[model samples]
Target: MDDQRVSILERIGLEKPLVQAGMGGVSRHLLAAAVSEAGGLGTIAVPGAAAIASELAAARSMTSKPVAVNLLLPFARRSWFEAAAAADVVVTFWGTPKRRVPGIWLHQCGSVDEAHAARAAGADGVIVQGVEAGGHVRGTEPALELLERVKAALPDYPMFLAGGIATRTDVENAVASGADAAVAGTRFLLSDECVAHPEYKQRLLSANSTILTELFGFGWPAPHRVVANEATASQAGPSGEIPFINKLINRASAAGARFTPESVQRRAVAHQSPTSRMLTPHAPSEDLPRRFVEAGPLYAGETVARIDKLLSAEKIVTSLVG
Candidate 1:
C-alpha cells in the first residue's frame, strides 16, 4: 500500500478505519462525540451557522478525540463554512466542491468524474457515495463499484466509502477496495445517541426496502432515498416516478429556495405546504411529531435491512470494525 493513500487514516487520527457519516440533524454532539471516543472519526452534521460552534464545542467537551462536520453545500453559506472552522475536518455534500474551510476538507462524490473534480478543487479526500446511500442518492451504482472507479483514477488519494455499509464484511471490502475508511450513516442513525425521532427509528427498524424519489425536494431538489411512506406513495406512479405536474412544481420550489430568504424559509418550514409538511433536508429529530414523520421521508440506506437492532454509538463502531 502506498504511504500517501494509507496515511490518510493516520492523518485523520483514526484508530480504526471507520467513520460515522454525519446524518444531518440526526448526528449531533452526543452521537458524534461517542463515535470519536470509540476511536473513529465522528462527524457532527452542520446544524446551522448559529449552532455549529456550540455543537462542536459540546462534542469537543465530550471527547478529546477529533470530530468533524458535514455540510450540505446547497444550503451552506460562506458564514456556515467560516463557522465550521473549529471542526477537525469539514465534509461537504452535493454542489460544486470548494475549499471553503481552511483545515482538511472532504467532499462526497457520486462518480469517478466528481472525484476528479474534487481532487482538482484541492479537496483532501473524497467520500465515494453510492446510490444505495441513505438520505440521498448520488452515485448511480453500488458503493464498491463507485470506489473502484475512484480508486482507479486516483489510486493514491485518500478516500472514504459510503453507502451499502452495514456489516463488518462491508468495512473490510471498503479497505480492500482502496478506501481509507468506511463511512456509515444508516447504521449510526439507529444508535441510541442519535436524536432521530423515536417514531423514525421504529419505522426504519422494520423497513426492508427503500425507494429513491424527489418527493421530499422542496428546499433542495435532489434525488433522495427513503422508506415507503404516504408522502412517496401519494406522488409515485406504479413505476415510482412522480407525475409531470408535480415534477415541475418541485423544480420550481428548488429554484425558488435559492432566492428564498432564510426567514421565509423558516416560516415555510414552520408552516410547510401539505406536500412536504414537516420535512427538511435534514432528517426529523426527536422533536418532530410522529404524524409528520410517518408521512415524511424516512431516509435510510439499503443496509437498513441488515440492521434489526439499535446499539450505542461505541458498540456500533466496534461492530463495524470487528
Candidate 2:
C-alpha cells in the first residue's frame, strides 16, 4: 500500500493501519513491544503495573516505539489509571470516561452514540469495537453499520474499527468504510509473541465457533468468546453461581499471592465437586483456571478460525499491511 493510502497509520507512527488490541493479562511486555517494533501499533494492559514494575520495564526495554496502556474502568484497584496517566498512550475499557489522563485516551465504544459520548467526555480518540470481537462482546450493531454511524456523527474524530478483523480483505473493508485504522485481537492472539498459553492458542486455532459466556467481570456485561474447554463447557447460564474454586482464586489473587498451576489445581479440586476434572497437564499456569472459571468465555473474535499458525510480529505486521 502507498504511504498516502494509510494516512492514519502514519499519524500513529505505524507502517500499517493494524493495531494489536490490548488483551489485559495476555497483552504483556513481550507481545506489546514486539508489535510496536514490527511497525504496527502495540498496546499494553497495565493491570499488573503497580505490582510488577518489571513487566513495564521489559516492555520499555524491548522498544522505544509508542506503546499504549489500557485502563479498565471500575477496577478494584485504580493503579491502572495511574499507569495510564504515565503511559505514551492510554486506552479506556470497561469504564466510564470520568477520569482524565495526560496522554491520549482511546475510549472504548460500541456504537456511534457511545463514540459521541466518549468524544464529549474528553477522549482523544474512540476505538469502535463491534460485537464480533473475541474477548469482550459489546454493541448490537454490526461493524460496518456502526462505523458508518460513527463516521457520520463524529466526522472529525479518528475512528478505528475493531472486531473480527483478521484478513487483508478485512483491512481493505475497514478503510473503505472510513475507518482510520483497524484493531484486531484474535489475530494477534495467535502470534508467537502473544503471552497466552500454548493450549489457549491451540484451542483458538482449532475451534470452529467458540462459546460466548457472559460470566466474566470488570463491570460491563461483555461476553467471552472462548473455545469449548472443560471449564467453558461446564459454565452455566448467566444465573449460574460462581463456584467456590473460582471464589478462592479471586480471594487469593486479591491478597497478592501469585497463582501457579499446582496451587490453583489444589484449590480448584478442594472447592469443586469430585466429578470436576477440568484441570489438564498442558496448561501453562494456574491462571488459566481462574480465567476460565472467573473470566470465561475467554473473550475471542470470530476471526480466530482463520488463524492457522503462530507468527512473528514483523510477519504479522507485513501480512496485516498487505
Candidate 3:
C-alpha cells in the first residue's frame, strides 16, 4: 500500500483495507465488534444517543480494537454526535460537510465535489458511495469510476470505495483504482452479525436482481435501491417507474425536508408523524411487522446477486480482504 493508504489504516487501527459499512439498525455492537476484532474497521450505526453509547460500550468491551460510529446527517441529533465522541472514528453521511466528532472523522460522499467539500471540512477520509450502493445512494457514477475522479482531484486523500463491492476481486480492484479501502454493505448485511430479520436475509440469499426507486420515500424520501416487494410492486409500473402521484410525493417530501425541523424528522423515524406511511432508512429487523416485511424496503446493492450464504462477520471480513 502507498503512504496515504497505510496512514489511514494505521490511524483507524485497521489491518486490512476493508470496512463493514455502518447500516442503520441492522449494524450493532455484535457486528461492529466482530468486524473490528477480525481486523477490519467496524461501525455502530445510528439508533439514538443512548443506543450509540450502549453499543459503543458493548463493542469496546467485546473487542479492544477500534470501532467507529455512524451518524446520518438527516436523522442525527446533537446527542447522537455527542455520544459518538467516545468512538474511535465517527462516520457521517449526506448533507453539508461538517466535523461532529473529535477523533478520526470520515464523510461518505457521492461525488468529487462532495469529497472536496469534505476535505475542506477537515474530514480524515471519505467513503465514495456509488449509485449501485445499497441504502440511500448519493452519487451517480460507478464506485471505481468516481474513486478515480476523486483521486485525481485530491491525490493522497484517504478514500474508501463503496458500492459494487461483493467479492475479493472487487476489494483488490478498488485499491488498484486508488481507494485506500473497500467498504461493503450488502455483503455484510447478509452476515450473521447483522440484525436483519431472518426473512429479510433469506430474501437476499436468492436475490438475483435489484431496482433503484424513489417510492420508499416516507420519513426520508430519497433515491434508494432495494429488492422488489409488495410495496414496490403495487406502485411501480413494469418498467419500475412510479406513477405521477408517487413522484409528486417524493418531490414534495424532498422539498419539505428543507423546512421540516429535525425534531419532526426524528419523530417520523418512530412511525409517529404524518408521513409515517413512507419508509425511512431502517432495514427490516426482528418482528418489524409483517406489513413491513411485505411492503417495507429491503435495501440491497447491485452485488446482492452474488452473495449466496451467511457467514460470521469475521469470515466476511476475511473474504473481503482475501
Candidate 4:
C-alpha cells in the first residue's frame, strides 16, 4: 500500500486495514471493542440515536481504541446523526450521501454512480458492497468486480471492499485490487464476541449456500443475502414486492417517533413482533420464539460455506491481517 492508503488506515487508528461490518444489533459493544483492540476498525450498527450513544459508550468502556458507528440512511431519523457524529468514524448506507457529521464519513455504495455521488458529497471513503455480501445487498455484481469498477472511476478515493471476505487471502486480494481495506460481516457474526444466537451460529456453520431474497423486506424492502432456511423456503421466489401488511407495520414503527433511546429500542426490537420475520437473534432478552432459528432472516455472505468454527473476534482479526 502507498502512503495515502497507509494514511487512511492511520487516520482511523486501524493498524490492520480490516473493518468489521456493522451488522445491526449483532455487532454490539463486545464485538466492536474486540475487533478494535485487535488492530482493526470495529463498528457498531446503530438503529437509532439512543442505541448508538449507549453502544458507543459501552464499547469505549471496553477499549480505548477508536471505534465506528454505522447508520442505515434509509431508516435513520435526523436525530440519529448527533449520536453517529460522536463516533471516531461514521458510516452510512442504503441512501443518498450526505455529511451529517464533522468526523470522517464513509458511505457504502452499490454502483459506480453511487460511489461518484458519495465522493461528490465529500465522503472521506466509500465501501463497495456487492451481491455476495450478507444482509441487505447493494450491488448485483460480485464484490471484487464492483470494487474494480469503482476504483477505476475514483482512483484517488479511499475504497473498501465488502462481501465474501473471510480469510487472510481475501484481505490480501482486496488490498492488491486497490482497496484500502476489507470489510467482513458474516465472518464476524460467528465470532465469540458477537451476540448472534447459538442456533443461528450453528445454522451458519452447516450452511453451504446462500440465496438472495426480499422476503424479510417488511420494513427495509431491500434484497438481502441469507442462508437457506424455512423462512426463505416459504417465499415464492427470489424477488417480489413487499407485502402490504409489512409495509403498514414498517411505517407504523417509524411513525412520528423522535430518535430517542426508548423509540430506538422499540425499532431495534421490532423483530420481536409476531408478524415480522426480521428477528434480532443477537438480543438475548427479545424472547425470540424457538422457530426463529429457521423462520427468521439468517443473514450470511457467500463465504459462510467456508466458515466452520466460532473464533474470538481478536483471533478473527489477527487471522485476517496478521
lDDT of 4: 0.82
Clashing pairs in 2: 134-299, 134-300, 134-301, 135-299, 135-300
Of candidate 4, the 10-residue stretch with the lowest lDDT total is 278-287
TM-score of each: 0.95, 0.79, 0.92, 0.88
The runs of at least 3 residues in candidate 3 whose Cα sits more than 4 Å from the true structure, single-residue gaps closed, are 250-277
Q: What overall lDDT goes with each candidate model?
A: 0.83, 0.66, 0.84, 0.82
Q: Which candidate tops lDDT?
A: 3
Which of the two, 3 or 4, has more TM-score? Answer: 3
Q: What is the C-alpha RMSD of each candidate to the true structure, in Å?
A: 1.8, 5.9, 2.9, 3.3
- lDDT tens digits, residue span 4-81, model 3: 788988988888888989888889999999999999999888567898999999999999998999987866778889
Cα lDDT tens digits, model 2, 237-270, are 3333445564444444433322233456446434
Candidate 3 TM-score to native: 0.92
- lDDT, candidate 4, 52-150, per-residue tens: 899999999999998999988766887788988889999999888998899899999999999999999999999999889998899899989999999
lDDT sort, best first: 3, 1, 4, 2
Candidate 4 stretches greater than 4 Å from native: 238-287
- The numbered model that scores best in TM-score is 1
Model 1 Cα lDDT, one tens digit per residue, 198-258: 9899889999988887777767868888887676667665445776766666677775565
